[model samples]
Target: MAKKVVTIKNLEYEYPDGTSALKGINLDIFEGESVALIGLNGAGKSTLLLHLNGILQSDEGDVEVLGMKVAENIREIRGKVGVVFQDPDDQLFMPTVFDDVAFGPINMGFSEEKVKEKVRMALERVNMSGHEKRAPHHMSLGEKKRVSIATVLSMEPEILILDEPTSNVDPRARRNLIELLNGLDITKIMATHDLELVSETCDRAIVMFEGKIAANGDVEEVLTDSKLLESHGLEAPVLVRLFRDVMNREYIPIRLEDVIEKPNKYKI
Candidate 1:
């Protein structure tokens, strides 16, 4: 079995204004598992994600990442769990792409030579090589997103957390991002509404509803259940819904490649 990378038990959190963001959330994320946290706008997906790396601490419950308590070892845990926020601007504050990517390693006390090597490798991983000196502010949204991911990659985190990674990017950029994420080998917790990206990258699906976990299972099973998805203010991927509604097919196809492999098998 895969070793558990993160564990949350009876976790609950509330904002200063008495807004309950997470309630009784229990989750276990294993090493190397790409899990998608899916929910509506206020379903508390982001709230739960914040607890994973100690950004938000629950008063009533506990959270542990990489075998250390988030509350006590937050400084250490933050280095292990790299988070890329929804907006690239939130993550890319350094002047240039190289600076932004090197910040994480530098903060970890890496030597100048090591930091430079890390930045180069991370940029290459995200296919943003040769843009080191470019200012992030001048880059397009897609480019900014890639650089944002590279910043986290420089940390060489054991777990990668991304919030709405595909949001606001063009189709080609989205596709490339999906491919890039798929190539990475790490535990990933992605909170996103993009079912297409979820299907492409995650093997497990976690659906949150009103500050609690409504459903958790294999990506295909949870995403293919139109009733469960609709009840949670979500809809299945377009291809999955089409197979169910129009073709009246019993099995839902989540990826384009699956449909293309045997189009006649799904004939209406």
Candidate 2:
């Protein structure tokens, strides 16, 4: 059996103004599983993510990561779980790409040589190896997003949490981001409005609505449910809608490649 990397029980949270953000969320994420958290605005997806790394502490529930309680082992958990925010600008504050990528490893008490190695490897992983000296603010959104990922990658986190990763990028950049995410062999929990990204990169889909988990299941099972998605302010992927609604096909294809590779399977 796969190890459970993150466990949440009866998780609840409310804002300072008494706006309930999360209402008794219970979830478990297994090792090396890529899960997508999909929901509309004002849902509890972001709030739920904040609790994973101890950014938000709910008075009502328990959150555990790597078998360690978040409330008690916050510092250690933060090191092992890296969060990349929705905006690259929010993550990249250092002057240069090298500085931003090296910040995490350096703060973790790594020696100078180790920090250099970590930075180099992280940049290489993101395919930004030769652009270390470039200023992050000057880079395009796509480049900055990769560098933001590199900053977290430098720490060598076991779990990566991303918020709106494909949010403000062109089609080419979005495709690149998806490929990059698919290549990484680590536990990933992403909160996104991009259903296409979820279809291509995640093994499971979790739908959040009105501060609670509306649905949770395999990627194909959840994403293909047009009714469930529609009720919760989401829609099936374009290809799924086309096959089920337009073509009136019983067989549903979740990803674009699925339809491309086996056209006869989806034909009625």
Best by lDDT: 2
Candidate 2 residue spans exceeding 4 A from truth = none
Q: What is candidate 1's lDDT per residue for 1-268, written digit by digit as tens?
A: 8899988999988999999988898989999999999999989998888888888887789899999999999889999899989999998988889999998899889999999999999999999999999999999999999999999999999999999999999999998899999999999999999998998899999999999999999999998988999998898888887888887896678988877897776653
Clashes of 2: 0
Clashing pairs in 2: none
TM-score of each: 0.97, 0.98
Tens digit per residue, CA lDDT, model 2, 178-246: 988998999999999999999999999999999999999999999999899999989888989898889
* Strongest candidate by TM-score: 2
The TM-score of candidate 1 is 0.97
Worst 10 residues of 1 by lDDT: 259-268
